[model samples]
Target: MNFDPQTLRYDERGLIPAIAQDAENGDVLMMAWMNADAVARTLQTRRVTYWSRSRQAFWVKGESSGHVQHLVDMRVDCDRDCLLVLVDQTGPACHTNRRSCFYTALRDGAEVEIMAPVADPD
Candidate 1:
């Protein structure tokens, strides 16, 4: 069956949450927002694209930094309000140069640094 982006649920701002995960390791890389257009673009181009709420624009993963995320697959949640993007992540997925944006963990009511930022490339 064919997929349709309009069938997915979106927030008042016409946005939905999207999570990026490592296709091989299953490690979650980052979470971002996507509008219908971004979703369509990602599927059409096979490149992960996200809606930047702050910038109010479309952010194609690794467009500038070369930390590109090549879309392996895209999944819609049961509620159709969220997305899971399996990707071949190139470099750090976080602005801090970390592999994943989920670097902090709340354990036992304490915040802990789970992963350090990736060192800058030479």
Candidate 2:
């Protein structure tokens, strides 16, 4: 079956939420926004690309930092409004050097940091 990027549901800004997950361990890495073009670029290049809402431009993962996310697979949600990107993540996925962006946990009505940042490379 042929897949089309336009077939996916987008928000009013023509953007969709894309969640990056570790392909081998099944850990969720990060969540970002993507336009249709960003989605196409990621698929074509095997590199994760996102639309930076604050930067108002296309953001390629690991472009600036060395923490590259190589696309392993891309999945669409049942509602077609979200995406799950399985990737071979190199280094820390979070900008803070954490393995995943979901570092904080709300437990017993208290917020706690569940993960620590990885050590910097030499």
Estimate TM-scores for all models: 0.94, 0.96
Error of 2 at 96 (Å): 0.9
Q: Model 2: which residue pairs collide?
A: none
Candidate 1: tens digits of C-alpha lDDT, residues 18-122 = 999999899999999999999999999999999999999999999999999999999998999999999999989999999999999999999999998887779
List candidate 2 segments past 4 Å from native. Answer: none
Displacement of residue 32 (Cα, Å) in model 2 is: 0.6
lDDT of 2 by residue, 75-98 (tens): 999999999999999999999999
* Residue 107 Cα positional deviation in candidate 1, in Å, after optimal superposition: 2.1
